[model samples]
Target: MKTDKTIRTHIVFSIAIVASALLEPCANASSIVGTKHDLSSYTNSSGQICIACHTPHNAQADQLVPLWNHAATTTQFTLYSSVTAKSVPGQPTGYSKACLSCHDGTLALDSFGGKTPAGAGKISGANNLGTDLSDDHPVSFTYDTNLATAHPGIVSPASAAFVDTAKTVPLFNGKLECSSCHDAHDNQNTFFLRKSNAGSALCLSCHNK
Candidate 1:
């Protein structure tokens, strides 16, 4: 039989230990946890980390995507308007909003998660890519799948691309997602593109004609 004081002390200690363990993962998850974002290197600010873009959290409306912060862009983006473009924008669909959350330059990159550094750390810094998105090709809508419907499928059986044997990355009916052409990690192609469509091969991969 222990005194009430002894029991209370033990309980308090147990709670403290459990709390610390739970916080361990949260602390470790951040690449720029306590340390401020390096101004010289352009690393993300405090509380923002690699997990900010690639984790399990509130995420975006797309649901297919991983963790994301920053408000999804609502303004109609300016795209590369030309005859060569095979897609047309009707309202951004699928995870296209999530892709724009970063690429569109409307939202600050470190707005979500926890605290971020003030002043120079803001994404609006001259070097930080901002809302003028005209340079990148348009990405809100789906591509012309009818053109590639005739090709023999080349994707692997277990690959995500194989679910619809006839479907292709460039031909998805839904909105084009960042994942459509890029795999966030360990990409063999430059800019994390899913395949080597460099130069003309990239365009010809789907637009066979």
Candidate 2:
């Protein structure tokens, strides 16, 4: 009782299923869909992942980041300081400030889309960097040939935009920042690191020792 039309429909369905299976790996390879940063669970959200940090239209103009959706943090952070260190870091700026909007404990994870959060869920435990940044690795500082020449154990940067010739590590406007080592979108490496930290390989990329 097999009709020609029924057989053709079956063949088309089978092809669609096979095509979907082939494209799934590509989707899972690089996306923020299931990552910790995906905050689409918010009840008021559009149920889209990128809406947490980006918008298609009317993004905040004051924010240096492209299409910024989250409210900027206004905390006057206590920066890292050292007597021997040559790099004099001032206040946190640009991308580092963007990351601190949630990590600083001042803003909720759902503090985006220009609406107040329903719950006070904040970045806690080790994920919270807090207002005091004395202990953490120094960010939002200029790292160039001048700094490298003056500072010990620091390697000279290939260019203002990137740290390595491979260009794996990036700098925000010639300054090293939180995003320099971390890639916000891809979590293929844990902690959202740009590369594996095994044996401090990521650290060695910038630091000579």
Candidate 3:
């Protein structure tokens, strides 16, 4: 007994509901906003949370990304290297340096936005990577066809199957970095990982074994 107009209205409403449901997760606030990274405890009356690592103007000029408010670390790192490792990791560059700005534990957490807060101090506990990176996973390394050939266990980044999916490990300018494994803005998975490591799926994304 319904008219064509009524049927169209119901269809439109259903589509709108489905669209909102799909976009909810993406619209949700990032975990880093109010988490320990907030650094408002040491900030001087600036209640803005994102200001800890980002700014609207006067960002770091040398940084690859825009709106970088934090001071980049200068500590020379002892990069991860092993006899079995094929890729040559030179140094932490790009987003890896942005993560190390606070995580390296050499600089004060509140040392951002061109103003160091009073009683500011370095990061502590497991979050502190320090100047030594020998114990951590190798970063800032090329992960291309040559490296994949040397280490047959790893899938080539250029492979269609490897690059087709959204969950795959990302490379920055054809080089793997900390952001390759971790999504700093998202914490849907543990350790801010790009994808859930359940059943070692995240690890298996690149490594065949």
Residue 15 displacement (Å), model 1: 52
* Residue 203 of model 3, lDDT score: 83
Q: Give every collision pair in model 1.
A: 197-202
lDDT of 3 by residue, 1-209 (tens): 99999999999999999998676555544566444555666656867677777888999886645688888888899989898998899779988998997889878877787765553588889999888999998999888999999897988887886886434478888888898888877765657788889998888888889
lDDT of each: 0.49, 0.80, 0.80
Query: lDDT score of model 1?
Result: 0.49
Candidate 2 backbone collisions, by pair: none
lDDT of 2 by residue, 1-209 (tens): 88999999999999999998676546645677766776779534467888778888988665747898887888998889898788978788888888998889888887787866754788788898999999989999998889988987887786442334336687778898989899889877767888889999889887777
Which whole-number lDDT from 0 to 100 does residue 173 have in model 3? 85
RMSD of 1: 14.9
Instruction: Rank by TM-score, highest first.
Output: 2, 3, 1
Clashing pairs in 3: none
Off by over 4 Å in 3: 1-30, 44-46, 116-119, 166-168
Point out the higher-scoring one by lDDT: 1 or 2.
2
**Superposition TM-score, candidate 1 onto the true structure:** 0.50
Model 1 ranges off by over 4 Å: 1-50, 60-64, 83-86, 114-135, 144-173
